[model samples]
Structure formats: structure tokens, C-alpha cells
Target chain A: MKGLLIKDFRLMKSQINFFIILTAVTVVLAVFSDNPSFVPGYLPFVMSVFALSTISYDEFNNSSAFLFTLPVSRTGYALEKYCLSLILGAGSWLFALAVTTVSGMIKGTAVFSETAAAALIILPFLFISVAVMLPVQLKFGGEKGRIILMIIFGAVFLIFVTALKTGEAIGNDIQAISNPLSGVNLKALFAGAFIAGAASLLISMKISCSVMNKKEF
Target chain B: MIKTENLQKRYGNFNLNCSFEVKKGCITGLVGQNGAGKTTVFKALLGLIYPDGGKAEIFGKNITDFTPEDKEKIGAALSDSGFSEYLTVKDIIPILKALYKSFDEKFFIRQGEKLGLPLNKKIKEFSTGMKAKLKILVAVSHKASLLILDEPTAGLDVVARDELLEILREYMEEDENRAILISSHISGDLESLCDDIYMIHNGKIVLHEDTDVILSDYAIIKVTEEQFKSLDKQYILRVKKEPFGYVCLTDQKAFYAENYPEAVIENGSADKVITMIIRGQEA
Candidate 1:
């Protein structure tokens, strides 16, 4: 496992450095800007792109044969990609947190507790992106993989926007199905996120492993 | 040791139905013309492509049954493929060392110097001959029991080819248990190195014989039309007739020599046998 990690790290050292620079810039911008909502929103999306690039590297370089030759199992390879993404996602959230804290401290504003929110919101998105990308990477390789990713994400984005507009049109007329403790609770949301993320990651890893295992070189 | 049982691979128009074995401690050469299933065989053995039918086993383990542990004992290189171009010889060594359980770093570095592979330079920057040399170096450096090289000396000059073959010979001497399977279109490399030869065409093994037997048993006879007419059809495996006379490909060299002492008979090398087989297929 450590060997696999080292291999992945070596493969992505330059990309990781690029991301760190981007993260630093984002951190600086979020700290200086007056918007707290925008800080959390963009971080997860950027982190997802970073995760996607790893697949791109594998495809572009024809690294599959090389990676498969290594002592690492296919299952280990799939799991390692997911693990790396989650680690990076966590780092992104933490960086965002630091930015928010610094921004709030500088402006003399009361800070909201964001620990639960970070875990709930960021982790699931990262895992889902990973889940969607792994199978595609296995099937189409990295280059075409990213193009497929963009198309799928684009269609989802269009549907999401339409749903938002429809929700606005039917505003307040639709009686919310309210129940005791049915409101958005950050704690419950975090638990749900963890469960969903874990499930998707596990399923994705399984699928990726099978695909990789069957792949010849 | 490597073995294949009716191994079949189909890629739309191209199909490879090959079966042969490289016995332990002997170099088996796969000799074929360009696009004659050399690379396909290597790919199938490495489990780089799923065979449509049949089986491939390396060191007694089927590719399907192989875990990561099984790969450590095998070292392979395809004809026109390699590590990423972004890597230099220096970068590639560490990566392969980490992957293969028995990677000999010192051996690799020494071969790198011997083969004239520039360590600091990226692979993309190297010449084609240099790249070929690098791949061969990697395959020989590993503590692998089986080394599968596909056109390992393709683009090399005479000097480089000799150097590379010499290095391979040294590597082979280290362990009596080790074996190698080299595929090359050029016959000289195989003639000098291989113990047994497998001649392939259109995805099938046309001939599998010992190197010495192939050299001694086959003969190419150039004779007049009358002499060719007089020759027994049973002795002639293939005949390419020109306007001048006939060029006969025969398996029974001694019988033909003794039977027709007056006929113009020339002893054929392994290269001529392969050529005759190819011409026979063409005809």
C-alpha cells in the first residue's frame, strides 16, 4: 500500500504542486473577499477537477501497463485513487476553513461552526466524482474519460438549473412535507454524507478493480 | 518456463492463433515477418490482451490465476511500447525497482552505461535505437526467471546489437533456471542466440524446430526445369519456379543430395528455410 502511494505520488508530483499553488491563491482570495458562501462553494469543485486530472495522467501517459506491472493489486490501485482524492478533499476543506477563519477574524465578524458542514458537503461530492470517473477511466482511458465526464456533468448541471427554476416558480404554494426533526440538521446530514460517500467509493472501487483486473496490460 | 495452449487472439482483421513453449534454460526465438503475430504473442503472454480462446501460462501459473506476486518473476517488453516519455532512464529505474521484487538496480545502472542510454535525458528525447536499448536493459536487469523481448534489437547497428546480445548472454549465464523468448524479424539474431525457433505466419506456427536441425535438415536447390521435373514431388516441400529454372525448398537435404548428385544443390541456412516457408505461404 505504501509502495502504491509512493508510485501515485511520483506520478502526480508536478500536478500536486500545481494544485498547491492554486489552493494558495484561492486561500488568499477567500480571506480577502467579503463573501464566505463563495469560499466553500468553489473549493469542492476545484478539488474534484484536481482528482479528475489523476485519471487524465494515467490515460495520457499510457501508465496502465506500467502500473499493472507493479506489485500493487488492481483493487489496491482503485482504492488508492479514491483514498488520495478523499485526502485531498479533506485538505481542501481544511484550507477553506482556515481562509474562512482568517477572513472572519480580520473583519471582526462572528464565525459559524463549519466542521460538520465541511465533512457533509465536501466529502460526498468528491466521492461521487471519483465513483463516476473510475469506471469511465477504466472503459475509455483518461483522455476520453475527461471528455465523457464533462458531458455527463454538463447534462446534470442543466437538469439541476431547471429544477431550481421550477422550485422558484412553485415557491411556498408547495407545502413542505414537514415532520418532527425533518429540517436540515448538519449532524444528520454529515452522517448521511459519510454513509453515501463510503458506499459510492466502495462500489466504484469494486467496479474499477474488476475492470482493471480483466484489462490485459 | 512459458507455455501456451492453442492461444488465440483476434483484432478485427488480424488474428493470432499460436501455441509454443520456451523451455527452461533455453532461448526460444519467435521468427516471423512484419505483422506476422510476433507482438501479438508477447501481448497475449503478458495478459495485455484477452485471448479469444486458449490459455497462456508463465512459470506454471495461468494469467487469470496470477496475482501481483506472479508478475515479479516475469519481465517483458513489447516491440513498439514502453514507459512514459516524460521519464528518463534515471526516473524509470526507481519506478521499475519499486515494482519488480527482484529488480537489480546496480545491474540496470551498469547496463544503462553499457548501452549508452542517457540517464538525465527523457525517453522521448532519445533516438529509436537508444530507446530499444533502454527497454532491453530493463528486461535483463530484473531478477526475472523469464525474459520476453519483442524485437529487442530492431533498430540497433551491428556494434550495438553485438553489445546488447553480449549483455543478454551474460545475464543468461547468471542462473541456469532462467529462460528467454526473443522475437525478431531478422534471422541472424535468432540464429546466433536461440536454441529452438518457431516460425509463424498469418497467426499460426508453420514450423517449430531446433535451430541446428533447421539449419542442417533444410536445403534450397537451384536446378534446371528438366532436373526439377525429375525430382520427386514427395521430397519437395515448396518450389518457386523462375524463367531460368526452379528453386526448390526441401526438408530432406541428405536424401536429395544423395539421390540427385548432379542437380545444383545449395545448403540452406535458417534464414532460407524461413524465406521458403514465407514463399510457400505466399504461393
Candidate 2:
């Protein structure tokens, strides 16, 4: 598993740099807008793109067949990908927070309290998206999986837009984004997301193992 | 040693049903056209893909039973994939050393120096032949009981191919029980390196025999079309009719030569046998 992680990190070096640069740019813009909440919501979606690049690496380089031949188990490989994606997304979030804090200090006003709110709210959604996208990437390769990803996001966007336009009271049922940490129940949300992420990870592992195991070369 | 019993797999458009045993201390060559299940066989043996039916066993244990400990004894290089292009030979060596208990870093370094593989250069920057050599170096450097290679010399020059083969031959001196299985469409390499040959067509193995047995027992007979029509069908495995003559492949070459002294009998190798079988299928 360690070997697999090392390999993935090397493969993802370019994307890692891109991710850092992207966060820097996003932070600058969010600071200028004086809306810190925007970073967390927007960062997950952008980081998802970078996460997609990792899967693309395996497909483009034809490394799937080779990596399986090593001593690493299929289960191990799947776990590594899931863990890496989570870590990468989390790392990007932290960096954005740091940048946002620095920018907040630069400006006189105490702004971006919403940004912390957004991170807490958006983190679970990111987990769900990753958990969903992983099996698709494993089942279908990069190109087809990317198309599926776009379709899924587009559908989600349409639903979100429709809900807003209808003036739905869905927001009332959901926890308020005020006070970032104090307004919401952190324990329950964390537990739920952890369980959801774990379940989704297991599903992804099973799918990847079975699909890869049955592949003929 | 490796064995497969009625192993089968279907990849939608392609299917494979291959069964063969490779003994220790001998090089076995798998010869097949593209998409004839050579790579599939390699994958199945390494447990990369599960068979739809049947079983694959290495060293008498089922492939699925392999733990990381068992995997250390085997090394392989598939043609379509190898080490990641992002890793340099230097980085790869250390990773492999850490992964495999029996990884011989001294041998790896020696081979790298000997082969002129750039230690700091990423694989993406290397030529196809160089990449092939790098894979061979990694696979061969390990102190393994078996080496599985799929088209390892596809893009190699003549000298490079010979050098690789020579290194493989030297590996034989390290351990008398060591074995190698190499699959290639190139007939010349198999003719030189393998002690036995297996030919695959479509999804089935068309022929498997010792190299000497194939060389001596199989013969290509040239006959007029009329003669071909009159010839005994029992002795002929396949007959290819050209404009002027019929090229007939026979298993009972000695018997046919004794019976038809007037017909021209030419010696045949494993490659000719596979080609003739493919031609017969086309006809």
C-alpha cells in the first residue's frame, strides 16, 4: 500500500502543483469578493477536477494492468485511491483556509465567517461525490468516466437550480450555515459522513476488485 | 513451474481457453497473433484477472491463494504496460527493493549500468526499446523463481534483443530450477530461446510440443493440386492451395515421406506450424 501511495504521489505531482495554484487564485478572488464562504463550496468542485486527473493518469498510461501484477492486492489499490482522494481534498481545503485567513487579515473588516461555514457544509458533499465518482472511474475508464462525471454534476446542478427557483423550504430543514461550527451539530454530521464515506468506499472497493479481477489482460 | 487447467475468459469481443504446463528450468514460448489471448493468459496466471471457468496454478498452488509472500517469487513484464512513466529507474529501484524481500539491489544497479538505462531519466522520455530494456532489467534483477514476459522484445533492435536473451540465458546459470515464459509474435526469438512452444489461435491452443519434436515431426509437403486431391486426408492437418501447388502440413512426416518420395518435403519449425494453421483457418 505504501508503494502504491508513493507511485500515485509521483504520478499526481503535476496535478498537485496545479491544485495549489488553483487554490491560490480562488483565495485571491474570494478575498476580493469579501465572501469567505464561497471558497469551501467552490473548492470541492475544483478539487474534484484535480482528483479526476489521478484516475486519468492510470488510464492514459496503461498502468492498471501493470500495477495489478505487483504484490499489492486489489483491495489495497482501491483503498489507496480512496484515501488519497480524501487526503488531497482535505489538504486543499486547509490551504484555502490558510490563504483566506491571510487575506482576511489584510482587509480591515472581519469577513469570510461564511467561508468556514461553507467548508463544514461542503466537506461531506465532497466525500459523497468522491465515493460516487470512484466506482464509475473504476468501472468505466477515464474518458467515459469523465463524461459520466459531467452528466452527474449537470444533473445535480439542474436540481439545485430548480429547488432555488421553486422557493422550496428545503433550506429550513437543513442545518443553518451561520456561526460555521456552533450553528450545526458537528458530531452527528461527522459521524454520518464518516459512515457514508466508509460505506461508499467499501462499495467502490468491491466494484474495483471484481471488475479488475475479471478483466482479461 | 506454471500450469493452467481448462482456463477460460471472455472479454466481450474476445474469448480464451488455454491450457498448458511450463516445467522448471526450461524456456517456453507462447506464439500467437494479436488478440489471440497471449496477454490474457499472462494476466490470468498472475491473478490480475479472474477466469470465468477453470483454474490457474503456479508451483502447484492456485493463483488465488497467492499472498504477498508467494508473489515475491515471480516477476513479469507485460507488453502493453510496465513501470509508471513518471518514475525514473533510480526511484523505481528503491521502491521495488522495499517491496520485494528478495530484491537484489546490487544486481539491479549492475544491470542498469550494463544496459545504459538512464538512472535519472523518466520512462516517458525514453524510447520504446529503452523502456522495454528497463522492464527486462527490473524483472530479471529480482531473485525470482519464474519470469513471465509478454512481447518483451517488440521494439528492440537485433543487438538489444540478443543481449536481453543472452542475459536471460545467464539467469539459467544462477539457479537450475528457475524458469522463463516468454510470449511473442516474433518467431525467430522463440526459435532461438525456447525449449518448447505453444501456439494459440482464436481462443484455443492449436499446438503444443517440444521444439525438437516439432522440428523433426512436422513437415510441409509441396504437391500438385491433383496430387493433393488424391493424397490420403488422414495424414494432413491442413492444406493451403496456391496457384501452382498445394502446401500440406502433416504430423506424420516420416510416414508421409516414406509413402510419397516423389512429393517435396520441407522441414518445418513451430512458426510454420502456426502460420499453416492460421492459413487453414482463413481458407
* lDDT agreement of model 2 with the native: 0.79
Docking class of 1: acceptable
Which DockQ-derived CAPRI band holds candidate 2?
A: acceptable
What candidate 1 gets wrong by more than 4 Å, as runs, is A1-4, A14-17, A36-48, A61-63, A69-73, A95-112, A115-120, A172-184, A214-217, B255-264, B281-283
TM-score of each: 0.89, 0.82
Q: TM-score of A-chain in each prediction? A: 0.81, 0.76
Q: Which candidate is the best by TM-score?
A: 1
Candidate 1 C-alpha lDDT tens digits along A1-217: 5555554555566566777787787777766776664566567667755655666665554656655544556777777776777666677777777777677777776355653354347667767777887677666777777788789999999997887778668772224423334677957867788789789888888888887767766
Q: Residue by residue across B1-283, what tens digits does model 1's lDDT show?
A: 8999899988889888888999999999999899999988887777667789998888888876777788778777767677666667776776776677788898888778867888888787998788877877777777888888888989788887887788778878999899999999997777878899999988999989898877788898888989877878687877886787888888789998998998878876777888888785222
Off by over 4 Å in 2: A15-20, A23-48, A98-122, A168-217, B11-15, B216-218, B221-265, B277-283
CA-based DockQ, model 1:
0.40
For model 2, what is the error of residue B63's alpha carbon versus the real structure, in angstroms, after optimal superposition? 2.2
